[model samples]
Structure formats: structure tokens, C-alpha cells
Target: MNDIGTILGNEQFARKQASFGPGGNVVPIPRAKKNRQPPHSDTDRANVLPLPSTNIPHRTQSGLIPAHVRVLLIQKNTEDRHACRNALQQTSDFNVELVEAGNGGEGLHLACQDAFDCILLDCSLPDMDCLEFLGRLTELTSGLQLPLLKLVPPHKPELAIEAVRRGIHEFLIKDEDGHYLKLLPVLIQRMLDNRRLAHEKQQIETLYRTLIEHIPAITYIASLQISHQWLYVSPQIESMGYDRETWLSNPDLRFQCILEQDRTMVERAFAKSCETGELFHCEYRALGRHGKLHWFVDEARIIRNHSGQAMFFQGVIRDITDLKSMRDELETHRYFLDQHVQSRTEQLEKRIVILESCNTELCNQLEREYLVCNELRKANNLQATMLQAIGAAGVTVEESFIHPET
Candidate 1:
């Protein structure tokens, strides 16, 4: 087999030999001078013929070439070879390389060697039928991230459909006017764009998975209107007694998993939130797979579309059963303390009233005793005054009698 370098070298040698003669008899051809146009001039337009309007809807002037695209052309016809070259050259933006393979076997060999941006597969080859080629190609590129475009004859539309079913990106039919070549550039651009988009999507999915794995709370996205189906659930749902498949398969099963008493309140709050497009927050008990009940406080907000219609809800659920139990205990203690304080206050007031009544009776008794003592002292003084008067009068009479007798 001739390598590319050897083939190019041989072609250059043949061209040089054809230009000379054995007896020094040579044809003189003038070398054309290279044209140097002004920098402001439209130089590319001068170098290449413009593609027909039907072929390229718009001309690109951005001068940005997408990253190099590897193309595998598996057509055996010479016309197809020329047409493909013309199409690639007209693109002016894609770096397209042609790897010509005569049969599907050879094509599959090339496809397995390296990753390609797009594979332009000729459906009919001399050695293999289109179906066999597609089947083998499917197996070859099954795990690959590349896109494939199959080429087929115009009469067989059925093959195109089958090709699509086999995971081919798109199919093109070779026509008489070579219009199929025009579609190649557009197809190439689209494939590259799709590849870039696929890469970005994969990256986003990876980031989402990583975030869901490490986050502490249970996170999910659920539909707002249709059965409240869970579109996505974090890995934490497994710890909460539900897997992603189980949740997605039956959304109402989640309500059944909730404790019967809390189910009604949770459903009511959820419905209100969906209707009002407000934040939903509620504490509910979830029945685990083991029949143990765990409390969770769900906090979610409704997501709305551009027309202000509720689309879905996204949020987190936190375990708060312990906190709730503690709160109830604290409330009970507070109630007991309040009752005890109130009873003690009533008892103290009654004792104060009884002490006041006893003090008033003691004051009345002391007043009576003081009045009786004053009366007794007055009577004793009166008796003493009367006795003194009587004694003085007796002494005066005795003194008179003694004087008469003498």
C-alpha cells in the first residue's frame, strides 16, 4: 500500500517528467505572476467562485473557522470524489479531510482508528450492501460521541429511514445536478454545532449529579400540575426511603408514604402553593420503608413559565422531627410553670386576707381592756378622797370633847 507521502511524491515526479523531453525538446509555458490585491479589497471573493444562492442561504464573513473536522468519504465513484472536494472547499470554514474507502469493511476500519467529527458514509459499496454497512457502523460507533451522515441513492427513501433508526444523524441522496454537494457544508456545520452542544450538556449533567450527591438536604424538582410527578430527585431520596425510579414511576406514592394525619395538611399546603405560585413550607411525617416515621420540613417554591403559568416546583426537605419534639416539650414545661405560679399567687392572697382579719379583732379587744382599766382607777381615787374627809372630821370632834371634860 502506498502511503500519502509516497503518493504525493510520485505525482510530483510524474508532473515534472511530463513537463520535459528526452532530447531537450520542451514546450515553453509562461509562469503567471501572483496577483497582489489591496488589503481592503475582498480578496477571498476574487480567489474562489461564489456558491449559488440556493446552496448557501447566506455568505459568512466572520472568518472564524470551527475547530478542525475529520471527515471520512466512502464513495467509490470519481464524480462523488470531485463533488465532495468542491463542497468542502466552498465551506471555507471547516477543515475537512477526505479518507476514501472503497468498501464498508475498509470504512469501518478507518472509523475505528480515531474519533471523527462526522462520517460521510456511502450506503452502497461493491462489497457490502447499505444495510450491512449501517449495521456494522452502528456497532463500531456505538460508544463513540461522534455523529454519522449516510449517503444513499435518491430512489431509495426507505434506506434513509432505516439509517435514522440505526442511529445515523441524517441521510443525503445523490442527485443528477449534484445539488447534494451543496447540502454537505450545511450538514457539517450543523453536526459540529450539535457536537458542541452535546458536550456542554454532558458537562452540565455531571455538575448536577455532583451537586446532588454532596448536598445535605433532600432536593428535587416536581411537576406543579400533572400528578406532581418528580422529574428529578437527589441521591438523598434513597436515604429518605425512596429511589429515583420509584418516585418517578408513581408520584402519588409519596403522599401515601407520608403519615396519614399529616398527609391532608401537606397536600393542602402544596396545592395552595401551586395555585398561588408562592413558597410552600410544611412539616410532615414521612413513613420510611422500615415502617418507622421520620419528620421532614419541606420548603419549595413554584417555578413559572414565561406566560406566568406554574410549570414545576423545586426545593429541599429538611429533617426537623427532633427540633419539633424539643419545642413541644418546652411548651409543656412553660404551661406547668405558669399554672404553678398562678396557684401560689392565689394562696398568698388568701393568707394575707386572713392575717388582716385577725389583726382587726386584736385591736378591738385591746381598746376594751384600756377603757375598763381607766374606770377602775377613777373608782379607787374617789374612795380614797372620801376616807380622808371622814377621818379629818372625827379628829376635830374628839378634840372638842376632851377640852369639855377637862
Candidate 2:
């Protein structure tokens, strides 16, 4: 068998077309400077042309291609269908999965059953023609979910444009010498790149949705109305007195969550921020649906236009009931310490005054006792002098009358 027959086991090319030798084998043509254009045909006609065989296998399978890339090939010709499968598997970057269909009807059946990275359609099919298949398939993937790459006849410019308008990714012209086989890998690679980008976009959107549902704080968008109406509320709003729907739809309900004592404080800060278009922050108490009062930090900003008109309010509120409880407990402790210190200081001042008075009285009593002792000493000295003098005089008298002086 020749290389063409080996590529797809195609025997029609051997009988219908001529090759080089007397044995009559089909020669693989060189890559043409430019692929030959199709003979004059209606551009609006079907996309596929009758070529070789209609014998599609029950399920033609190959070694597993990469799980990352999957392609669906709907071609009736055995040669073209297998040719696409082989080229896609050989791609260096993609692990390509190629599912074949005998006709457009079979292709549609497989497409609806499962999802793929892309769809490759031959303009012609045996059961359903290419145009009908494309129209119906486009309707199936209306949101341009699955990218379509069509293999069209070389000169069908009109049909190609229509296919694009219907949201086909690109229409690559077909060649008779099988040159499109080399281009097929590249086209599918482009389609896969686009598909990956779109897949990432969807993932990001899903992530945002999940975060909105499970976040720890309440996020909201509200209009600056007298009722403090909410426009949008996150899932966490359920912790506050309302569900998301009730908070947004019932404007008066949100205000009801604010305690009567906190209404003035919250209103002042919120109103000031709205008027100034500044970021707002406040701590207030709220009544939860569970009949519990909780503290929250209301932080938000007034979104405004260039003209300084308030457009809306966007903000987050974190539950701070634990923090508030701690703060109040600390303040109470501080006040108690101040009172205790003041009482101790006053007691010490009173004791110091009593001690100073006792010290002054003790000094005065010691001075008077010293003065009394001095007077007694002076009187004793005078008596001793008088007695000595009297004894001497008596002695002189006694001596004259019988030694009495002794």
C-alpha cells in the first residue's frame, strides 16, 4: 500500500487517481506553493464534497490522547476522518481525543451526549449536509460554548462568511492534495487556546459566587435613602436580622435591626459620610433575628460621580461584639483603680497631719521640765552655803563656852 492508503487505508485514491509507476500507486504530492482552488461551484451549497468512503467504524479508537484537549470530527469520508484524528494526536502540546461520526446525524447525537473542547465539521456529510448540521449545532451551543472549526471547499467564500456570522470560530479552506492535514493541528490548537481562556473566565465567575456565599462579613450596596434601603446584600446578611431578599426588598426592615440607642450614633456617621463622600466607620449594636444583640463595625464609603452627587453606598460590617465587651470591661476596671488610689491617698494625708501635731506638743513639754530642774538646783546650792556658815558660827560660840565650835 502507498503512503496515502497507509494514512487512512483509502483504496479509492488508488483506482480513481493516477500515480507515478506502472503499478499505479497514488503518489503523495509535494506541498503546493499554494493549494489549488476548487472548481467553480455555488458558495452557498453544502460544506462537504463527496470523496472516498462512507464506511464509519462502530467506534474507531486510538491510544489515549491528552485529557486536556478533546475534538469531535464529523466526516463521512474514511480518509479525511482518520487523517484528522492522526494529525491531532501528533500535536506536541495537546493530548487530543478524536471521536468520529459517519454523518451529520451521528455527529449531532454524540455532541448532545457529551462536551468537547471543540467541534471540527466537514462541509459535506452523507445523512445530513454540512449547512444543516452547522445551523442545528450552533443552535445547540447558542452561547458559543463549543468553538466550531469548519473545513470548507476552497472557493466557497459566501458560505464561509455565513458560518462565521453564525458564530463558527474560523472556516479553513479544504485542499484536494490533503495539505489541510498539516494545517488541521494548528487550527485545532488555536481553538483550544480560545476554549481554555473561556473556561478560565467561567472559573473566575464561579469563584466569585462561592466567596459571596461563604464570606465572614456582610457586604452590601445600598442607596442613600431615608429608610437606609439596601440594593444588594451578601449571604452573611442573614446573621443580622434578615435574609438577603428580606433586607433588600423590605427597606424598613434593616433599620429595625438597629437598636433605639444606637440609631443616633449610626445615623450621624452614615449621614456625614454620605454628605462628604468619605469612608465611613462606626460601631453600633444590632438586634439579630435570633433575639440577640450584637456589636458590629459598620465600615463603608459613599460612591459618588464627578459632580459629587452620591451614587450609592458600598460597605462591609464585621461582628465586633466580643471586642466591644472587652473594651467595656477594661474601662470599668480603670475607673475602679482610680477610685481605690484616691481613697488611699486621702487616708495617708490625714495620718501625716496627726503625727505633726504630736511632735510639736512633745517639744514644748521637754523645755518646761528643763526650766523646773534648773530652779531646784539653784535652791539646793543656797541651802548648803547657809548651813556651812551657821555651823562655823555655832562652833565659835560653843568653843568660848566649852568647845561648842566643833
For all candidates in order, the CA lDDT equals 0.68, 0.68
Q: Candidate 1: worst 10 consecutive residues by lDDT? A: 6-15
Among all windows of 10 consecutive residues in model 2, the one with the lowest summed lDDT is 1-10
How would you encode candidate 2's per-residue C-alpha lDDT over 301-362 as one tens digit per residue?
88778997777787888988888889999989999989999898899888888887887888
Model 2: lDDT equals 0.68
Off by over 4 Å in 1: 1-65, 224-226, 307-309, 325-406
Instruction: Give the alpha carbon lDDT tens digit for every residue of 1-406 in model 1.
Output: 1111111100001111121112111112122234522332365334432222224334343333244556767776756766776667655454565556666677777666644557788877878887787777668766453567777777777887887777776677766656677668777676556565566666666677687668878888887665888777777778767676777788688898898999999989988887777789998898887787778989999877899776678889987767878988999999999999999999999998998888898888889998999999999999999999999999999999888864
Report, for all candidates in order, the number of backbone clashes: 0, 9
Runs with alpha carbons beyond 4 Å of true place in candidate 2: 1-68, 75-97, 103-115, 120-191, 198-216, 221-238, 241-252, 264-268, 271-276, 302-314, 373-406
